[model samples]
Target: MIGAPMETKGLNANRESKPNRSRKEIIEKKKAMDALLKAASAEKDHLSAFPAFRRYQTNGLSAFLESGRGDKLASSVKHYIQNLLKANMEGLYGSEWPVEERVKRREMVAPEARYIFVREASNASASEMSTMSEQESTSASCVEKRGPMVGFVHFRFVIEEELPVLYVYELQLEPHVQGKGLGKFLMQLIELIARKNQMGAVVLTVHRSNSVAMNFYLSKMRYGLRRVMKFFAKHSVMRLKLSWRYVSVSTRNHLRRFIWFNKVVNSTLFTKGQNPAIEVLEWIIQFQQNALIIVI
Candidate 1:
């Protein structure tokens, strides 16, 4: 799945009529894709000690989780969804989650900001999506052991606005399925989701220090860096967009406006730390004053 995009990109790049593609650019892109493919096959090393997604069972208000790692990615994901629904409902019917809770909930449960990959597998012997409902799928299947219980992802909407623009919420693989280029294959699965859904983009946020993730997103997948924030865990927001490649004039202008707003807001917000630029100039002057250490 993850490997699918590399193949597609290679073909697309080949057919492109652009005359200014530098030899260096082509080499770099190929190298990046190769690395992505390799990582897609890695049996697991520096990555999270275990699987990226898992499952959980709840008894009343208390929830029990099971994940490859202690973090219980699946349980966390479920809780996250609950939080969003809570937020949405609270908005209309006298809230419960306060501001702090809202932020915490977002950190726990929001759909990924960016996703380099996604996979949408229908039940091999399927019914039409519209005719079947969420409950029907859950009731029909025995909680697909081949992959994570992707009940939420399988739901359909007539519009893209209803879904997260960009995200890679989870990556689940069975042991035998581990490595051997399946990750890339899974990513292609996601790409189809983004493209077919008519999403303007796909995005994922990773810890700033998560070099492997950052490399996969920015280098291999060609997702653009969108935001860098110090949210408890510093993270880089990245996006895969079809817009920048061929956006409308109005859209481009709106982006220009956003850039202007960002500059003004960020300049004001980043004004702390005593102006290092001024501090540097002061230090230079101080050095000049001390240079003529004459006893006059």
Candidate 2:
């Protein structure tokens, strides 16, 4: 009888400690996330850690990279991002563009947004500025003689699914710069940034109608689809006429806003000491993968 009481007391003690332990774990996790974010944001230049990747000169294209924040971007650059994204993606959305544009405008200026801009390079030391009036008064040591902006990548380090990740919001390039391997190079750089920051993976969303971009990502970039589903199905927006047939208005609209979530292949899949970007490129030749697509 005495031993039974002691065992019952011990069971009660464990039952009482479980909640405390769980609570402690939650608190520790939150602290770790905050610390990781703080460390990443504290760095002035993520690219500085990889100098070789700062300049991409290959396949008849020459460009250098510079970093900026959306909120700190010069007015001209903001206009440029708006114009470039519209030129590249407007047709894919059709009637949903105006609303999508509004959303993009707001998102572009969020404080957390980070940008990596590609500028034309004339030589290793300097860039040749173009006619665009996007000149910003930055320190000479940071950026010098920045050339015409040919492309830009917008990404953020965020916690997703309880794991830290770098989410690519936009990867826009001027039409002239397309097909020159710049996009693939930018994605590779993005993956490196994710890895350097200790992120679990890299994530991005794409439009289903943009088949060329879709193929480029899956067939060339080796980004795997993480999920596919409907988003904002209950929400309605103004409708417009279209020449296409065989689909209801809501379905058409939903399809118009369909989003695909693409994630870099899990890092663990790669062998140790091998370059992840190169490995990803090698994987592309053998498979056609599907990325996550969401209907919004």
Candidate 3:
């Protein structure tokens, strides 16, 4: 009878120990799964590195992607962007933003940034081309021989709303190159890169006072305005949705505006007593309205 009681106690202890062992095994499996996910993410980032060379035949321009954690290169890019912004957005930002301070801030964040430089390709010397096997070295020398830098696009890959996107921080070109369709070419290249990397969208912010830029993005490129926030109080966020085809409805609207302007210009009322300056002001107001249609 005493042996029976002892056997029952032994069975109860074995049952309790089984649950503990099962719990430990479950914990181990969960940890392993977490580690595997982390490793896979890192591998994907490594594999998705941007290509060093891209050529746009329409503009006779070639762009090279410079990506790394190098501070010197980042500084150079920051300086370039700063010059561009000072010329383009100084009025929009007003006197509150000093160029030097803005450049400093950009430099601090640039180590994590990637730059696409517009360069001309030079026929490399035979000896240098034959001796260089490393792509990095080849690119560095190519930049040196390719003459002065004409323009650059600074962008980064980011996750927004749980989707991967390419964010364009700045796209700047020299005054001589501005009207030659290079800006559109650069944006096209950015979209292509985003698509190649499986990004969902391309996003950028434009200053409200920069009407030319706003028109280029909305009417020319068909980027839809996502939202207008008071954070900057003077900027609008624009996004190009990559999942759908972009219709040229905006183009048709612009054509209609042009036709209306021509009709008004030819009208007797416009020529009889109305001042020419008044007509110009009317046209400007209409243009502004068209640009703001997508804002809010």
Tens digits of per-residue lDDT, candidate 1, 214-259, equal 5655555554443322222322222222111111121111121111
Q: Report model 3's TM-score to 2 decimal places.
A: 0.52
On the 0 to 100 scale, the lDDT of residue 169 in model 1 is: 36
- Tens digits of per-residue lDDT, candidate 3, 238-290, equal 32321211111111111211110101111111221122333332443456432
Would you give me the overall lDDT of model 2?
0.67
Clashes of each: 23, 4, 0
Q: Is candidate 1 or candidate 3 better by lDDT?
A: 3
The residue ranges of model 1 lying beyond 4 angstroms of the native Cα positions read: 1-164, 169-180, 226-296
> Which whole-number lDDT from 0 to 100 does residue 119 have in model 1?
21
Global lDDT of each candidate: 0.32, 0.67, 0.49
Give residue 105's lDDT in candidate 3 (0 to 100).
Answer: 53
* Clash-forming residue pairs, model 2: 225-291, 225-292, 259-294, 261-292
| Candidate 3 stretches greater than 4 Å from native | 1-53, 57-78, 99-104, 120-142, 231-296
Instruction: Return model 2's CA RMSD, one decimal.
Output: 9.9
What value does the lDDT take at residue 185 in candidate 3? 72
Off by over 4 Å in 2: 1-7, 122-144, 231-259, 264-296
Give candidate 2's error at residue 254 in angstroms: 5.7
Give per-model TM-scores: 0.28, 0.73, 0.52
